[model samples]
Target: MSVSPEAIRSALLARREIALIDVRQEALFALGHPLFAAQIPLQRIALEAPWRIPRQNTPIVVYDDGEGLAEPALHQLRALGYTQADVLEGGLAGWKAAGYELFEDVNSYSKAFGELVEHRRHTPSLPAPDVLALIEEKADIAILDARRFDEYATMSIPGGRSVPGAELVLRAPVAAPDPDTTIIVNCAGRTRSIIGTQSLINAGLPNRIFALRNGTIGWTLAGQALETGRQESVEKGEGSGHDLARERARDVAYRAGVRRIDSADLKGLIADSDRTLYRFDVRQPADFAAGHPAGFRNAPGGQLVQETDHFAPVRGARIVLVDDLGSRADMTASWLAQLGWEVLVLADAFDGPLETGDDGAPPPRGPHGRYKRPYEGTDNREAAMQAYLDWEYGLVAQLERDGTHGFFVI
Candidate 1:
């Protein structure tokens, strides 16, 4: 028997755990789906299910938009040892017929959550022209790109250095040692820039800070040129101000209700057959490859926040984050907690031995179902970019109507 759309919505509103997965190409899933639906393409479920939905008995509801993919997907899941798998009754059509809301774009919830954060916190931002003027005058300022290294390398602000989201609190001191220097954080578009800037202010950084409004898209619209082939990045080791940043991050985590746990506590969480748990190391990919505790996968803290659905498909799951440096995990856990996750940070430093390798994430597949993000890349139609921003502005109201996201800003 299949699960009904109303049942899934009821579970979500009640904060119960369920994996309402969309087993279609990402593009199709992105076009429209319920707010909490996670896309796990039918072609990749076998490769991804083991880790992405780790627990065998997780309440799994797979659906497809009249594509006849759900049944096969359910079969593969059961063959792989999943016991509570079922199809979403009537598939995507059933969801629509039930008069429920469908969200667009990939990582929809995180994007919506980011909008909620800015809406509630009034995250500060400066228009591109003003920032450009500051830079042209050689003002005492630092531009840190809060994106992946590869994305930063593709194109960046002329003087910007890569200091991805999770790394901001950990490395801001080294990036801009002078307390008086102004700090600007930016991404391809608004979300990361807003989150990164707010993160520093929340962490009690003394430097004056602002997000470059609308990010690179805003800069491009204003006819300002972005520099390409930039390789500057934050230094890898613990910076001089690590202690201060760590303390501030811990405080933020505490305020957001994130718990600090040790190995013994973690063992109990793992043994709890009643709940699903996701373990990740919220450090840079390179740092994770160097060594990490067993069973923890690498998820750079910033991206983890941006792509929570992709990393942890099951809603209402318990998440445990690890970082040798306390601040990175604490900062990430703070955001996770606000996103309504039962998140905790591991305080113990591993002593005995650790596993070393890549994060074991699935290899990238063809762009068959990939959604084209207008904010990405240097060349995008101006109308599409503006429309993307417009879509984001309306998310807060839609979230209110959806009434399933239990997020709270701290």
Candidate 2:
């Protein structure tokens, strides 16, 4: 049976079982999407679906942005063993017409909260050009690229240190030993920059910290010069256990009005013989590559939480998380758990492992040879830059409608 926008809206509001899939490219989905809808480009469905959804018979509803794509997607899923697959009645436009909220930009809620935090805390940040000039003049600013090390090696602002996203909180103080040293966090785009800066802010570091405005994307777009390097020095820490972190995360969840579930409750739900259960290992590709649980697949934590619908389109499905360390899995799980998912953090398999670099790595840059973001649609022949900005502007309201964001200050 085809799903109507009204039905989808009701299901979302009631927090019922349903997976609303947007069979569009990542770029288009990023432009704007229903709060709970996940973006799984039609092309990657074959490769990603079984890994993400797992259940051959899960009820799956696919939609597109008024484009004639969902029909083919429905056929595709049916062929792939999704017996209950169907299409959304109106695509995204229909939902918009129904007055349901649409979120814009990638990581809408997290990015908005970042902006909110910056405004509320009056957090400091340096514009790309200013930061560039300071570097050229041998100024005091310590430019730390708060992204993955490999991303930094591809392209970076001259002299920026490679600090991976997760390590920022644990390693920032060491990066700038003196409290007086100015610290700047940056990623390929805005999310990590904001998140990295806030990580230090949350950690209660004494130094002045700021996110490099707009991150490396803004830097590259503005025609700023960049440097390439592979050498990185970042100190790593031991895993803080799930049990301890969960209790602490639970407090954070409680403050954000999120709920927690025990392993027993989760297992009982997993035992349900009729449903699909998806366990996502929301850590970096490198971490996932090293070792992960048997049933769990890799989807980075930040992106997983932000684009949950895309990852686990099967609504009401069980989602268990695995992380090598506690903060990322805990933080991401907190958001998803609050969103009314049966979320849990499985204990890390590795404790006190040999550390990786401590320097802030730059954001993933150049071409991700492994996974090209699908929705970054083929550059429109006639699309203007402003269209991109407009898409980002609308995402703020989308985050509001999604509700249960479960993010907060530390």
Candidate 3:
């Protein structure tokens, strides 16, 4: 069976459940593909198909650049019980022939959506030099690293503490109790920093909040030193701080039209075999391994939002986030809601007995097909870093032309 590019485009615009997969290596997929395409290389089809595309009846459309992989991929998907698998009519060439846009990078649309949020909301930011000056002066400032703790520990700004994106709203108050202290959020690159800073702003944090413009890339470009093996993190405990964060995040999530569901409602959603449901525990990996609600996989809220397509490949699928702390799930759901997802926060479901150990599945592909991200690792070339920032800068314009993204910044 063959599917037309126009048909896929229409389905995307209408927010229908469709999985447009690019059966190519990550490097090639990163070079160019459709705005909503998810890369599940042909070799890893068997490994990824079951979980990534959970619904056997999901409308699956595979494409390749005349690489002879699409048809085989469709067969593999079918063998895996994907009953509705089909190929793009003309592959990548066909998509181009139809005069549609081909986006670059794996998580292209999600990055573009982040740029859209910044463009729409004018998210506040501070350049690296200015932030460095404050640190040198020993000013009242709290630098929260919004990337994962492992990433933060690798290299970070001096005196910066790990508070990952999902933890920002929940723990920022505890990290910087003084409202007079300026809070600066930084990630490895732009997207998480923008989203993290905006999250705090949306939650109505009293402190002056700003994204470290261009994140660690800007800090390096400015000739600033980065700390290695730093162990600082937000103090963990429940108190008035947690209560305030919960209230604030709940307000933001409600404003973004995120639904709050009890266990019964979650069960009903799960029972609806017609729809695809993803249950996630939006907490840190260690915390998730320590204890999380049964049947929910661990997905740190920040990474989940930053890589929504990678995490939830099936577009239009419903997502239910579980978090005992309330703030992480609520804040994460708010962004997903704006990104046009039917997202909900699973409330009070974690009060019962919890399971331990990591239940999440790793990405199917190994090192062979993986594209080396310019923003990660310690040895990125200056040119590559600059090129990455350049790509991000153009996302807003690209998103405008794409026109299918139903993202709304709050």
Task: Please report, in order, the local distance difference test score of every candidate based on alpha carbons.
Answer: 0.91, 0.64, 0.91
**lDDT (0-100) at residue 14 of candidate 3?**
89
lDDT of 2 at 233: 50
lDDT (tens digit, per residue) of candidate 1 on 236-340: 455546777789899999999999888999999999998999999989988899999998988999999999999999999999999887888999999999999
TM-score of 3: 0.98
Model 1 residue 340 CA deviation (Å) reads 0.4
Query: Positional deviation of 263 in candidate 1, in angstroms?
Result: 0.5
Candidate 3: pairs in clash: none
Q: Candidate 2's error at 83, in angstroms? A: 4.3
Across residues 1-410, which tens digit of lDDT does each residue of candidate 3 receive?
79999999899998999999999999999999889999898988998888788889999999999989998999999999989999999999999999888888778877898899899999999999999999989999999999999999999989999998999998898888899999999998899999999999999999999999999998887788788899999875578878988999999999999999998898899899888898899999889999988989888999999989888999989999988889999999999999999999989877789999988585546678799888777788889899899999998888788788888887
Please list the Cα RMSD from the true structure of every candidate, rounded to 1 decimal place. Answer: 1.3, 6.3, 1.2
Model 2 earns a TM-score of 0.74
Number of clashes in model 2? 24
Per-residue CA lDDT of model 2 for 296-350, tens digit only, reads 6677765665456656776777677766655566666655664557666666434
Question: Which stretches of candidate 1 lie above 4 Å from their native place?
Answer: 236-240
Those runs of model 3 whose alpha carbons end farther than 4 Å from true positions after fitting are none
Against the hidden reference, what TM-scores do the models get?
A: 0.97, 0.74, 0.98
